[model samples]
Target chain A: MKSIFGKSKELEKNIEEYLDIVEEALLIFERDINRYLEGQYDLFEENLDDILTVENNADDILKEIKYKLYTYMLIPEARGDVLNIIESLDNEVDLCKKVLMQFSIEKPEIKDFIVSDFKELTKQSLKSAEQLVRGIRTYFEEISMVNEYVNKVHFYEHEADKLEERIKRKVFSTDHINDLCKKVHIRHFSEKLAYFSDLAEEISEILSVASIKRSI
Target chain B: MTSFLFISSGLFLGWSLGANDAANLFGTAVSTKMVKFSTAAVIISIFVTIGAVFGGTGTTETLGALGSVNALAGAFVVALAAGVTVYLMTCYELPVSTTQSIVGAIIGWNLFSGRPTQLDVLYKILGTWVFSPILSALFAIVFFKIAEYIVKNCRIHLFKIDMFTRIGLILVGAFGAYSLGANNIANVMGVFTKTSILASLQIGFITLSNTQVLFLLGGLAISVGVFTYSKRVMSTVGRNIFKISPVASLVVVLSSSVVLFIFASEGLESILLNLGLPTIPLVPVSGSQAVVGAVIGIGLAKGGRNVNYKLLGKIGLGWVLTPLFALIISYIVLFFMQNVFMQQVYF
Candidate 1:
């Protein structure tokens, strides 16, 4: 019984650490988003570099937890899905990293509304990560909040898509440049960064599945 | 009678100069469709008044010290000559510098008397005419190149480029205003300093400095100019200077300003002398001529064939003849008013 309690305490600690990583990633991401919104392109690039660094760190943490979970063979009912959930979480950070790297390269200018939406999404991502950790630590009562958080993430993601499409149309339609080199580059970067929204949805879907399967 | 005549004529000349020169601040921007005519007019008026009120100091001292105006009639003759020169320049659509016209008139007026100006001071003022435009053009070309390079290479989104350019223009406009304030403030107040008017006036605990009184008068004169006479000159400059692009306009403005500043700087004459060139003192250089020369330089840098020489030739002729005609007109008018119209010898 003591050994079981020790294992549970270790899991709780690991989950708490993961929450910290997500929160830090979101903060860096928020700063970059704001810098871009304010038209400080060079500062935005620097902030993006910091975010990419944080995302890499978060990826390492997610991987460590996945390895630990595998070694322990914990959460029997959710065993098969643990790797998927961890990978999805890491993929979210991975998408963020990729988007930010492109941002550093292209140094694309994001509009205010889009940046605000992105910041909101980052906040929701952090909330979902925290709730996921809570749900994992036998905090069943907090599980319901996870659904709302995930829902908010998906909602912001949809809004981001609409805004992205509008920007894409204007960019494609413009005749300022003869060829579409800059347009293609900026659009591709925007599309990739936008994939984070989808990753968040997959994370929520995976969590919902884990919750349902655990009950059964 | 002498004090009143001198003051009114000087104020009238100052007002006319403002009306003609204010457009230089906003004309290119307006011509390029970057800003509307009405918007440019209002902005120029407000900013010019503000600049004069808060900023026109260095140039005032330069004008005051340019030559000796020993009598009230000397001041009156100088104002009349400048006013006629400015109006004649306007008629020809030649954007001559009000500062230069005034300086030239003062010089012309000084030449009439036996008191020969110190050649060193005369040379220093003349040296500015040669250097201000050339230096301004070089700066404009370089600055425009830098601004263009950043815009093209930074990979900033298209919308953001437009947004950034708009903001950059506002900054450029502000800088132009500050330079105008610093340099042209001298033109309006130099006479007051020479005449020792408002030397020791104190109202409500605040002593009005010569510089401060000059600024107030400059501001008022500029306001009158903006409302009454700025439109015709604004339109003429807008239409005549090449089909202006925003980049080109920015280059013209920034470069002309750089030239104005270099001419306005202290020890500029000494620096020129050190270089073994004729030192031009802190003379009031022509803003319009500097801008025109800078524009021509931009044209040359782009390649010589890029500019319209006929238009440029016409403008150059206007510059040479404006003061000559003003001097002629004022010389004739002063002669006529004194000899033919009045039996009493006023002077």
Candidate 2:
């Protein structure tokens, strides 16, 4: 019996570590994007390395969590939903890594006027992912509080959407950069950053349904 | 040897009771894969045997009061009749209670032997048939409320809750099996008690009376039934009949087990009497009906949705039909045992 509870506590720790890695990657994404906008290439490259490491760690922990859950037969009733939530959260971390890698590769030259909008979009999108992590945590600990965090994810995702639109509208309308391809490239980055919020919103919806199914 | 041959029908009845009623104890746990079938079978066998040997007397005495069935051949026919009725009802997929069938069989024996059926005892047993389920439902409601409040207020992790619920299922399942053995053993071996020729056996510090020896045999027969035939019944009950969550399943098992314990435990009756409180009558009640009532209690707690009124009606119909079928079968079998088999069926 002690070993049974010991196994559960270990799995709980693994899950917490997995979520911590995801949240850490999102934070790195936010900081790196700001560094890129501010012309701090060295710091941006360093943070990119850090986020990649975090993303890899998240994957390893996720695999461990899945294996333990199946092998130990812990939470048989909610295992499927819990695995789905973790996999989706991993995707958000992957998105953060991909966004930073793209910024490094393409190097979209941004005008001063749209820099604030990009920074704001990065903040809002990461906020949605962060809120999603909280929602998943609440789903494990306190089911009733999960809905509150889910609503917050939705709220932040909506904010990110409005910012993405504003960035696109400004990029196309301004005469700051005359190259049409450059405008589209910057717009693409904006969409990629904003896509984190969309992913967060989707995960939050899954969490909502799973929590409802889990409610005794 | 003849005694063993005569007791075979009672053993058969014990087997049928175990096969059918074990599902009520651990059906959801095993069917949902929350607990393994092997573990459940082992635990149920051990606990049920212990309960039968230690705590089976109260309900057995109550059944004795209903009708003695003094001759071995007479007891054999009565038990065989009830067992057949239960088997047929189960084949037809109707809700049947072993307690009801056995009671009806005993009444049939009374009629055949020219002995007067004790009206007060008959009425008391009949009254428990109706009251036990209602009591189980009430217990379910109260326990469900307490469980819900704890879940909502505790803020425990989902994984931890799962762990606790798993452990709870096994522990509670043991109790349920014990109560089942204590309460329902009378239906299987109650008739044989009057005619059981087994002598008292000294085992270490304990001396088992002839009646306890009969109960031990009945309990083993029930264990055989659990091992041989209960898996399919558990699957049918866990997946098809209830469709409740694991936690709700735990609640149902606990509630029904408490009802069975209250009705079967002479110790509790004595305690209540000592306290000057109203004591519950010792009676053999239907484990199946207790489970159904608990499920309905959960449904009512959840605002009365999906209560399955049609199935309830069918069970109510079964309450009337099963005993009637058993009585007729008992009468016919007793006649054949006396005339065709040339056995003295009664005094």
Predicted structure with the largest TM-score when compared to the true one? 2
Candidate 1: regions farther than 4 A off: A1-216, B1-5, B31-33, B36-57, B199-207, B265-280, B311-319, B330-347
Cα lDDT tens digits for candidate 1, B1-347: 55655656667766875676666766656554545556665565566656565545555656656665655555666677777777777677666666656666666655554355567765666666666766777786687677656644554432233334444555566566556655676665565556655555476987767657756666677667766777666666677764555556667877877666555555565678789997445566777777777787777766665675764675557556765665565455545545675522122
Q: What is the C-alpha RMSD of each candidate to the true structure, in Å?
A: 21.5, 1.7
Q: Where is model 2 more than 4 Å wrong at Cα?
A: none
| CA lDDT of each prediction against the hidden true structure | 0.60, 0.90
Task: List each candidate's DockQ score.
Answer: 0.01, 0.71
lDDT for A51 in candidate 1 is 68
- For candidate 1, the per-residue lDDT at B38 reads 68
lDDT of 2 by residue, B149-267 (tens): 88889999888888888999999999999999999999999898888679988899999999999999999999999999999999989988768778888999999999999999999
lDDT of 1 by residue, A69-164 (tens): 656544432445656765666665565566556666667654443455444544444444444444443323233344565566566667657656
Please give the range of 10 consecutive residues that has the lowest summed lDDT in model 1 chain A: A135-144
